[model samples]
Every structure is written in structure tokens, then in C-alpha cells.
Target: MHEMSVALSVVDHVEQAVRPDGAHGVRRVHVEIGELAGVVPDALAFCFELACSGTVLEGAELVTRFLPGRASCAPCGRTWDTGMPPDMTCAACRGGATELLSGRELRITEVHWSAEPAAPDPGPAPHPEESR
Candidate 1:
């Protein structure tokens, strides 16, 4: 399924974002999924775990935030939860919708990572004469 590909892409994005900070591992990856985004959360979560195997994100948690579909009516400037169309009319005035304000998002919102281990400090080298 496409969820596997999406999961892989998420890993790529997470790596790109955390690599500069020398992050050793990912703790969690948060994402917002809209009702109209056409993605199955369960499948995506399952695929994410598979995609992250052997990577920095291995065993990382996937936090999903589900958003309800919403549409705004142009005639009356009203908004309501339409739940992904086929019934997107404004509840306030029963008018047609002009724009969709939200519920189409499918992107990573945050990435929590573990700090990389600090480099060990080396003591002063022994003197050349002491190297006998």
C-alpha cells in the first residue's frame, strides 16, 4: 500500500531534520491526518514501524492526530464540520461551501529525538620520553 511509501518518506524527512543536530535516535514522530487526506491511520502506523526498522527511528512511536473535515460557506460566512464532503453544505444557512478551511492535511508535525552521546574527552598524551 501507499502507506509504506509514506512511512519511508516520513523517515527521510525525520532524518533530514535531525541529522544536523546529531540526534542518535527518534523517540516519536507526530503527524496530523485529516479526514479527507485519504489515508488509513492503522495501515500507516503499521507501515511506519516496518519502514523504520534498522534506522534511527527504529522502535519510535508514531503519534497521529486526526482532524475532522471542515468547510466554510461563502454565502453566509459560516463554517461547520462536513466530514469529507457529499454533505458539505453549511449548517448555519444550508448554503454552499466556497472554501475548505482544513481537513486535508497529511504531514509530519513534530519529531522527538534522543540526544547523541557526547564525545569522550581525551586526557593529555604521554610525553615522548615516557613512551619507552
Candidate 2:
């Protein structure tokens, strides 16, 4: 499924974004997916887990928010929800000319980095020059 590719891309983006910060791992990733984006949420979630295997994003939580499709009519200057299988035509004036305002986006909004693991404590420094 294309969702796998989408998931892989998400992992790549998250990795790239966090790499500069020297993050140990990812805690959570928040993304916005539009209804018209054509991405299956459940499939993407499953694919995301697979895509994160052995990566910095492994074990990270994937949080997705879906945005409803919206369109604006040029003739009527009215905005309305297109819903799934979006109807591009305007409801008010039945205008054929319309502009999509939102709901085609597939992007990462935030990435939370996991806390760095604590270093093990060494007991103490050994005495110097104990042996001659």
C-alpha cells in the first residue's frame, strides 16, 4: 500500500528533523493528514511501526489528526466542507470554479524527543601510583 511509503517518508522526516538536535530517540510524532490526502489512517499506523524498525523513531508514538476537506467558491465566495470524496463544486452558487483551502495536506507538525538515557555511575576513581 502507498501508506507504507507514506509511513517511511514520515520516519525519514522525523529522523532528519531530530538528527540535528542529537536526540537519542523519538517519544512521539504528531502529524496532520487531510481527508483528501488519500492516506488510510489504520494502514499508515501499521506501516509506521514497521518503517520505524531499528530507527531512531522506533517505539515512538504516532499521533495523527485528520483535517476535513474544504473548498471555496469563486462566484459565491462561500466556503464549505467537501467531505470525503470531495465535491469540488460550490453548494451555494453551484459554481464550477473553486479553490481548495485545505484537506490535501500530509505533514508532520511536531516531534517529541525521548529523554536521554542516564549514564551508569562508576564507583570512584582508583588511587594513582599504588604500585611501584
Report the lDDT of model 2 for residue 116.
66
Candidate 1's TM-score reads 0.79
Least lDDT summed over 10 consecutive residues: which range in candidate 1? 114-123
Top of the candidates by TM-score:
2
**Clashing residue pairs in candidate 1 (N, C-alpha, C atoms within 3 angstroms):** none
Instruction: Give Cα-based local distance difference scores for all models.
Output: 0.83, 0.86
List, residue by residue over 105-132, the lDDT tens digit for candidate 2. 9999988886663233465777787543
Displacement of residue 108 (Cα, Å) in model 1 is: 1.0
Off by over 4 Å in 1: 20-22, 116-132
lDDT of 1: 0.83
